[model samples]
Target chain A: MNPSMAITEAPGLFTANGLTGLIFLVMMAVTLIGGLIACTAERLVRSVAGLIVCFIGVAALYYFLNSPFVALMQILIYVGAVCITIAFAIMLAAPEENKKNGPAGPLSGPLAFITAGIVTIGLIVMAMRAKFTSLPKVNGGSVKEIGIQFLTSYSMVFELISIVLLIAIIGALVIARAGRSK
Target chain B: MSFLTLYNNLNTFLYLAAILFGMGVYGIVTHRTLIGMLISSELILAAASINFMAFNRFTAPDPTVGQVFTLFIMAIAAAEAAIGLSIIIAVYRNYKSVDTEDLVELNG
Candidate 1:
């Protein structure tokens, strides 16, 4: 079912279709490089920056998956909220200056690499080989549909999440405020 | 089968998520600081969401279900980050350090 031209002939460099493909390729590169930087960088600040880049790429991937709502939420939640919160923690906690040189772990260097590689390879192989029965979509997972689902099916979870967020906020303030000198 | 058309394939996103999860595991294992570990844990969560989303896009009977699940994941992750960072702050205030090595009061 694959087109011969799709493989043998490259899509035109100037066309819109080609541009989307190009953008996807770029997003993939950004995600990979950002993840590598996030994992490997010695400094905490740079790692946070890399995390932002990685999240942006993931957002783009969500866009490709056809859920613009989730994609926007990915950017808003991950890049705007989470990354900024982490940056604030880095500033307040000051991981860089306080970073002590020590043995990372007995499994830090190569053993961790091998284990991660194995996990990655196993998952990829499983994903590639598995056959999914494509069930017909009940409703288009649009933003409107999502809103309805929140109000209808997922209302309980929705309320629970709000309570969780409230608790998390109050708990955070209380914990961080404790023992702070006036 | 074209490289440019990877966006159409379910396996592409799956492989991507797997790699991201692997990176997360590696980061958690190797990072010496609590904040760094938290950052890695976020990566793992992101990977899981991507998997849910990919299935939602491709084969799910109720597409809204996966999206809703992913949304819940984001909320949980946010809350987790908040609580975790606060704990790290408390730990830092007490110990004056965030390194796991220095945090070994239980080491026998």
Candidate 2:
């Protein structure tokens, strides 16, 4: 009876579990591949494309992390706004003729690889060694909860950010305009 | 762990953040152009935000704090990009080139 019961339940559980696993694997692959291209691509335009792809994968990761509000904001702010602004900057400043200049020096490539690798290994080791204590969740961390918190608990911060953004816009306009006259 | 179970663990996110940070570092150290450095800096900031969000999800009592902090990061990054790009434009206008090798005027 027990053997027959196990045999019957195994296939049902496998199909139910396998589909979600496959999706997660795909997303992870997207994230890593995007990161690789963003960092290693020779052309600046390809790097920017990689950055967009990576940001999208990150947004998906945020969704998996149980923050749909953050995931949406990630897409809206990082992918939609930031990437476009960067594209504009690239179009305005970088010329194709300069892209032919190869890497800075013979040692630069190896040195940078060593430095980044060391830092990554160190951080991973620290993360593995640290025994973190989980705290109790206070709220559901939903969009409504985040909205309330922004207005009530974090209202001052929200307002300050608005002011900062305003200042940044004015400053950018002033600086960019200054170059136009020359 | 199994394939679909990647998100169920904290270490997975931590490792991902580490790799992202490494990539950012590599970009910053390389790349002759200022705009490329700016992009790399954004990558570093994103890596930091990811770490904060992961800890907030897995450990913190008040998850709102991390969300708020990440929001602040986005605001700051936006400001940084604006200011940096403007500076790049000004630099390009003055120097006629954005390559780091050519911008050295104060070097004695």
Top of the candidates by DockQ = 1
Question: Worst 10-residue stretch by lDDT in candidate 1 chain A?
Answer: A1-10
Which residue pairs clash in candidate 1?
A: none
Model 2 lDDT, residue A121, Cα: 98
Q: Residue A35: error of model 2 in Å?
A: 1.5
Model 2, range B11-87, lDDT digits (tens) per residue? Answer: 88888989999989988888778877777787788889888888878788888778878878988988888889988
Q: Write the residue-wise lDDT of candidate 2 on A1-182 in tens digits.
A: 00000122222225855565466667777877887777777877888888889888888887777787888888899888888898888888889775733358999989999999999999999888887777778986877878898999889989999999999999999998885764
Span of 10 residues, lowest total lDDT, candidate 2 chain A:
A1-10
What are the DockQ scores of the candidates, in order? 0.60, 0.50
**lDDT, residue B21, model 1:** 98
Q: How much of the real interface does each model capture, measured as fnat?
A: 0.64, 0.55
The all-Cα superposition gives candidate 2 an RMSD in Å to the true structure of 5.0
State the lDDT of candidate 1 residue by residue for A1-182, as single tens digits: 21111234556757766787789999999998899888888888988999999999999999988799999999999999999999999999875554732229665678879989999999988987788767767887889999999999889989999999999999999999999897
Which one is best on lDDT? 1
